[model samples]
Target: MNRRMMMLALLAWACTAAPAVSAASPPVDDAATAQALAQAETRGREMFEHDLAAERATDALLKKRMRGDSRVRGWITEPKDNRYEVSMIGEGAVVLYRATTDARGILAGATEALAVPAAPTAYQAGAAAARTLAMQSRIDACAKRYNSVVLPAPGATTDAWTVYLLPATTDPAAVPLGGSYRFDIAEGRITSQRAFTRSCIQLKRAPRNAAMIVTHMLDPTPTEVHVFWSLWARSPLYVTTGEDVIWKIEDGRIHRVQD
Candidate 1:
C-alpha cells in the first residue's frame, strides 16, 4: 500500500480505539485501565514504526539520486520547530534532511537541510576560537588536514553549535572519519565542549581499520546530552561490526552504551 493509505488506516484505528477521557466520569476496573494503557502504547508504537519506515525509504531515494554507489550508513531523527531534522551519513557525505511529517495522516515537504549563509559575525568569532581549541585538544598528529561544517543545534536552549570535522588527506593511515564536537559559547568563551572520536573507540578493538559516525543527536534531559551512532569496519564489504550506540554527554565527558 502507499504511504498515505497506510497512514490513513493507522489514524483511523487510533481514533476508533482511543479510550475517551472524561471529566466527571465513572471509575474503571484495574483490568480495564491496564488494557486501555496497553492499547494506547501499541497504537503509538505502530505510528512510530510507520514513520520510521517512511523516513528510511526517503533516505534511500535521496541517496540514490545524490550518489549511486553509496548507501545510508545510519541516521538520527530529531524533532525541530514544526519539522524534523534527519542527519544522514553516507560514504563521504554528511547529508541532512529537513522533514515535516507525522501530522494529520500526511507527510509533507522533505528537502535538504537549510544552513545559515554565513555564521553571524559574533558567532563566527566564537566558533573560530572554539574550533581552534577543539583541534588542539582532540586532533592529534595522525590528521593531516581537516574541514568543518557548523550548524545550529535544534534543541539547545543556549547558543550552541555542533561542528563536524572531516579529514581531507589522501593518507589511509589517518583517521578515516573525523570528529563531532558540540560547542556552547557564552561571553566570547566556549562555556561547554564535548567530542566523539572513532579512533578512541576503535583502539579497544585493536589493529582493525575502523570508523565511527555520529548519526543522531538524541533529545536531551535536564542534565545530559544524548546521541546515537555507529561503528564500521573499513573493509571491502564496509562491515558494520558495531551496530549502534547511545552516548551520554555531561560535564564535558562522554559515556557510551552499546546496543
Candidate 2:
C-alpha cells in the first residue's frame, strides 16, 4: 500500500506539473518593449515631417521654374547617404537629379545634378511596406494628437508618406488652418512638417476661397497631378460659404492655388 501508492501519486503529480512548468513564460521586459515602441514612433514621425519640408522646398523651386520654359513633366526622389536626390524630368531624356538636404537642413544652395536611374517603383514599394509601422504606439500617438491622415505623399519618388492634419475650426470668419508632416517610410522618420494657419486664415476670410474639401484627398493622380478641395466655412451673416483650393502637384512638388 505505502510504496506503490506513493510512486503512483508522484507520477500523477509530475505529469500534471510538467505541462504547466513548460508553458510558463519568462519575465516580461515591459521597459524594453516600451522603449522599442517609443523609438519607432519617434522615427516614424520624424521621417514624415522631414519629407513634407523637402517637398515644400522643391515646390518653391518648381513654381519658379515653371513660370519659365523649364516646364517639368515628371520627377522622382532617391535617398542617398543622409541626403535626397530629386530627379526632375522635362520632355524626353531631359532628366536631372539634384542632391539636397534630408529635409532638416535649409534649402539654401543647389547641388550639382548627377545622372541617376529613375526608380519610382522602388520608392513606392518601400512606402507600401513601411506603412505597417504606422500602427506603432508612438506614431499612433502623434496621429491622434494631430488629427492626421497617413498616406503616400504626392509628387516625387522619395518613398515617403504624408501625415496631413485637419483644421481646428471651419469657421469662415475665424480662419481655417492645418498642418502636415512628410515621413520617410524606409527610414521610419519624419522628413519635415509645416503649419498653414496663415494660409487657412486668409482662405477662410475670403469669400472666394470658400469651397473646401470636406474629406481629405487620398490619391491625387497616377502621374504628376493636382487635387482640389471645396472650402466650406460659416459666417454669422451667411450660413455656409467658401471657394475651392487647388493643390497642384508636379514632379512631387505641391503648390496651392486659391481663387
Question: Which candidate has the highest TM-score of all?
Answer: 2
> Could you give candidate 2's per-residue lDDT for residues 1-259 as a string of tens digits?
5753454344335333432112112123477644433443343344333444345546655665433535454343445566555545454424444435564535535644434534435553344344334423242122123323344564546656754444333343643333332333435665554442222222343233122222123322111111111112221011111123223222222333222
Error of 1 at 236 (Å): 12
- In order, candidate lDDTs are 0.36, 0.37
Which runs in model 2 stand beyond 4 Å of their true positions? 1-29, 63-78, 88-99, 103-105, 111-259
Give model 2's TM-score versus the native structure.
0.30
Error of 2 at 252 (Å): 25
Question: Would you estimate the TM-scores of all the predictions?
Answer: 0.29, 0.30
Residue-wise C-alpha lDDT for candidate 1, range 1-259, written one tens digit per residue:
8754464454334324433111121133377644443442333333233334334536544664334424444333434455443444433333433344443224555445334222224444444444454455554433555544344443556556544443445544433433434455443455666554434222111133322222232221111111111111221111111223223222122333222
**Error at 11, model 1, angstroms:** 37
Each candidate: RMSD to true structure? 17.8, 23.4
Enumerate clash totals for all models, in the order shown: 0, 37
